[model samples]
Target chain A: MLQTDSLKFSYPKGQTFGFPNIGCKAEETLLILGNSGTGKTTFLNLIALLLRPSSGELIINNTQTASLSEKQITEFRAQNIGIVFQKPYFVNALNVSENLLLANYLGNNALDKGKAAELANSLGFEHLLSKKVQELSGGEQQRVCIARALMNTPKVILADEPTSALDDENCEKVADLLEKQSKIIGAALIVVTHDHRLKSRFNNQITL
Target chain B: MLIKIVWKNIWAKKLNSFLCILLMMFGISIISLLINIGNQMQDKFSKNISGIDMVVGAKGSPLQLILSGVYQIDAPTGNIPMSELQSLQTNPLVKQVLPLSMGDNYQGFRIVGTTYPYLKHFEADYAVGVVFKNNMEVVLGATVARKLNLKLNESFASSHGFEKEGEAHGDKKYKVVGILKSNNSVIDNLILCDLKSIWEIHEHEEEHANETPEKHTEHANEATEEDFDITCALVKFRSPMGLMTIPRLINQNTKMQAALPAIEINRLFELMGIGIDAFKALALAIMLISGISVFVTLYNALKERKYEMALMLSMGGKRTKLFFILMFEGLFLSLSGYILGVLLSRIGLWIASRMLDQNFNFDLQQSMLQKEEIYLLIAALLVGIFAAVIPSLGIYRINISKTLAND
Candidate 1:
């Protein structure tokens, strides 16, 4: 489970935000819909522990993360939370298989080639395992990004505008794939995006 | 995995990394080359002049006298009368005096007329035959025997002057009696003979010239004055008192001048030091420029890859690991540059030694690396670390939310 309580943040000489409380349980999906400049990316960053909220309480797997040190927070985030960003960004220097392996490496776990190949097989990109990420098509790269986020089987998965750039067909296919993968891994899935097409896909939805 | 990331990153920016390496190599090669040459030259000079304390010769440049009498690489000032050196030979402050009579050459190798004490000073053992005991017999040094392809009992006429194309003393042929083993000293390039042989050769030339019609009377008056003149005398003092007093006594009171080998060699080094120091400064400047190039390359790369770095951080990679990735890139370039520079310098020195052997008959082959080069490697690595550290500090300030939000 992942939960946040009255998350507030402010940038110097800029906007201040007082976000609503949100929670997601295992095998559940939550969609946060907002237009531009609604702080959707900032909310995803705070959930991923990439940004420290000024006044908030973040609980992942029943552990309060606000009190943890910076190093502990990094370790906790790596082992328990997965992040899938927009535009399917992969390290250009690494091949598809190495890119998957990088997730395990960053999470401080032993490399699991078997797990990587299994995820690739399920996502239907196992044949492109040895190929560079740059050579993949748009749909293929998004599927690879979903597989990488599931590498460590985290307790929570947070995605930022994952379907904004895809067409109607790929956007739905990507949303279905992300929800299916999260359910299979028994993780709480939360996606923050400005796309209106995803609003009907999730029953638990919020608009900012 | 960290290593793999570091290697991949370096390969991704191959051109910039190679430029940094090339610059470092230029600086390192110059430093290694100069150090090798300086050390070898110092070794050769010190080893060759260890026993000789002073050189007594006709009054002129003392440095020229030491160069000719001690190193055998320069021309003598003039010949001093043998009668004038008698006092130095029997003086209480002098331990031993070895007289040198030069003015002849055989195929560019100097022929020196000296006693067995000169060979003993360098510990030169005969390679094949015995030492020369007769006036017209000669003992060839190892280099001369191998270069000229001369054998024992073979006779060769000496040229009248030091030049290779000088007039040959055809009437007096000196037979090779011995060949010495290589001892890495001045003796390795000389042909040794008795002092009487050079004197007799000059006397014979004078007599043959007197038989000519026009100059017979003019040369006859000079015959009595030219008795047994020698080029110089190598003197070793019995005590420190000789060093304090003998050189000044000879310079002020006698026609002969005393030149200390230690003093002249120091003067030569002081003159060469100006050039070496300038070259060293140039090398250091190149090294600093290379370091700056590395800094600029890495800093710009960090700016361009900020999103990638943020992506890695969001994937749970530690900020320290990202910092090490850039640091390892700098270290990799510097390490490879240093290794290549050392190899290039050694090959350069080998080629230089071969050329000197073929032309000047001086051996300068040193295959071992110097201890100072280890310090140089450390310094190069420190430069690499210093260059990488400033840019790597950017890792601490990367606002992951801002960077990813912008992307």
Candidate 2:
């Protein structure tokens, strides 16, 4: 399970973000909706442990995150959490399969090519495994991004603007895949986006 | 996995990496070639100049006199009378006077007519038979015997001049009596005989045809004072007083000119140093430019890959790890360039040795790697590090969250 209490962040000479407290159980899904300038990305970053929060009690698997050192936080994040960014970015020098393997590498997990091939096969991009990521279409890239996030099989999966750039059909397929994959891994799935179509699909929801 | 990524990243930009390596190779190759030839020339010159204090030849360029008399690589200044050296033989300042008369060749090797003192001067030992005793008999240098396949008791006619195609002095053939051991000196390239032999050959060539066998035998024993002429003479001073007084005295007082071997060789090196210094500067500039190219390539790559770097960082990759990845790229490029450059220099030296062997009858032998090139390797490494480290430091400053959020 993942939970946050009194989460607050302040950018220097910029607006301070005050996030609402929320909790999501493993194998469950939570959707966060916000328009531009609503600190949706900021909230995701704090939960991702990418940026230090001004003040907060952030917990994942009953470990208090605020007391963790920077190095420990990076280790904890790598081992326990998987993040999918809205825009599909990759180390373009690498192929699609290598991109997935990069997650296992950075997370300090064993290099498991079988797991990468399985993720690609399940996400319906097995044929495109050796191809460069830039060659993939928008929907294919989104699915690949999801596959990359699932490589380490962490306890929590956080995706920001996961379906903002997708059409109606791809949006439904992506949302179904995200939920099914996260449920299969038994991770607390968190989706942060301004995509309104996702609201009716997810039972638990938050608006900033 | 890290190595695979580094390879992929470097291969992604082929032209940039190739140009950087090319620049480094060019820089290293030139310096290596110069070092090889410079060292070989210095070695040959010093070995040949080892016991001689002064060279007295007919009035001409001092450098030419040193080259002709000491190294035996240039044409003689013209002949001086053997009587001119007689006074020096008696002078207390002089230790030894070795007269040299060279006006002919056997094939491409010059026939140097001198006394036993010249062999003693170079410490040349008899590998076979004995030293030349008869006027027309010759003793071959070690290389001359090896190259020409001439052996003891072998008779070969001399050519009229320095070239192999010069008119043959077929009537008076030189009989090889002895062959010298490998001495690694200028003496190794000559055919040694007495000074009287050179005089008789030229005098016979001048008044040729219809000479009876009786007159041939008579001319050998009838060499007078006027017939005594030598190309030049190498002088050794018994004391430092000879060096202080002789060169100036001979240069000012007589038709003969004295050249100090040490001074002339040093002046030759100084003149050569100008061209060498210019080329060295140019090579160093190319290396600097290569370093700059590496800097610009990585700097631009960092700017363009900030998103990828930040994304990797968010995935828990350490900045130092990424920093070393870029460093490895630099290391590979420069090191490969260095290896190829050293190989190129060896090939260049081989070609140079071939050309010198053909033209001057001198071959340059050098070791695989010189002392300076080891230092060059270190220099190349420093360039690689400085070029890579500056740009890779940018990996640390990447704001992971902001970069991922914006892009």
Candidate 3:
């Protein structure tokens, strides 16, 4: 379970606060809705323990992230967090399988090939694992990133505009994959986006 | 996996990698060739001077004496009296002596006039003909014969002193009776004849003569004992007595000075050693600068790739792992450059040795990878790490939340 109390973050060069106060919890889907400049992505970053708050406390799985040292924060993020970026970033030189393997390297976990293959086949990414990220279309790359995010089966999933680049059909496919996979793994899902089309898929909503 | 990524990154930017490697190759090639040449020169000098224990010659700069008498280059210091040479030769500790008189030149090659003992001292082998037996007969080195295209029984006139156009001793044409085999020594560049021939050629000139005037002209045709004052006498002792006794006897009794070839040559190398070490330091400095360039480039790249780094960080990558990725990139460039540089150096030495063989008859072999070179490579790799350390530290400072928000 994750929660935040009066979480405040600001861009070092900006004049306004990112979000006055923000919070989230597990066992619920938090849909953060805001326009392009409304700090929706910043709020999700705070919940995911990717960014430290300028002033406030962030509790993830009951551990206060603000009070932890940098080393502890890194370990905490590795064991408890997973993130999907809007643009679907990946090491272009690495194939999809290697990208997935990287998650294990970061977590220092023994890779379970059978589990990974099962997950890849279920997500329609099994055939794409040996291909480079650059060789994939936007939808395929996003699916790879989503697969990479789920590689370690973390307790929480934070997606930053997971379906922005896809059309209606691919968007539905990606949204379904993210929602069904997160629920199946018992991870709390947080999607930061201004797209109104994805709002109907989530049960909870938090407007920035 | 980290190294593999680094290697692929470098391969992707093949042009940049090759440019850096070429710069390293150019530097290494020149340095290796110079080092190999220096090694060969030292070996040649040592090998040629091995038979002689000491050089007893006129009082002057010891280096000049060694260069003229042992290396067959430069001018003789001066001539000492035959009686003075004889006194040193008759010492109870003396073994065998070979006296050399050098004043003439055959087309820029030294024409050294000495006895058959001088030929035996070098262990001279005939590649085409036998050793000179008559007064006007001459033995040519392999280089001299090759350059002049002179064959057996061919004759050429000697020139006065060392000048190319100086007064020609045209009346004294010497027949080339022998062609010596390639020796890779200073002897390979000299023309040798009996000492009597030198005295006979300069009999009319007393300033050129050091022996008694009455006796000098008297032995003009016969090469009498007093016709020549010894230009330099190479003394070898029967035992190690010459190492201790010959120098003292020559210094105490005669106007001549006896110089040990090994000591003088070692001192020469020491003098040259300082400049060589400074050059090596300069080379190291250049390699350091190149390594820093590689580090700074990669580090700056890491900084620019912060968003990508943070994305990985958020995906569960440890900060230490990302830091090592950047560091590995630096090491990859250095190791590749070092190997390319060593290869370039070997090729350079091979080409240079081939070119020099035409004149020096030296088939110089470049020494293989030295332990010192390995140290240099390791130092280069460490320098790459050192250069990247500041940049890699940026990974720790990358705020993941801020990075993702910006993205």
i-RMSD values for every candidate model: 1.1, 0.7, 1.9
Candidate 1 residue B398 C-alpha distance from true site, Å: 1.6
DockQ of all models, two decimals each: 0.67, 0.82, 0.41
TM-score of candidate 1 to 2 decimals: 0.91
In model 2, what is the error at residue A169, expressed in angstroms? 2.8
The TM-score values for the models, in the order shown, are 0.91, 0.95, 0.70
The CAPRI category of model 1 is medium
Residue A206's lDDT within candidate 3 is 74
Give the poorly placed runs of model 3, Cα more than 4 Å off: A1-28, A35-39, A53-69, A111-120, A125-130, B43-68, B72-97, B101-232, B235-289, B370-375
DockQ of 2: 0.82
TM-score of chain A of 1: 0.97
Writing each residue's lDDT as its tens digit, candidate 3 over A9-71 gives 776686455464444555567788888777777677777776677888777777878888877
C-alpha lDDT values of all predictions:
0.88, 0.91, 0.77
For residues B1-407, write the lDDT of model 1, one tens digit per residue: 98898788788788988898898898888888889989889999999989889999998998999989998988999988888888888899999998999999998899999888988888989999998898899999998999999999999998977788989888789999999998878998999998877777877787876676544454445545334688999999999999999999999999999999999999999999899999989987888888998889889988887887888888888999999998998888888888888888888888888988767778786657798789889988998999999989899899887888885
> What is residue B269's positional error in candidate 3, in angstroms?
7.2
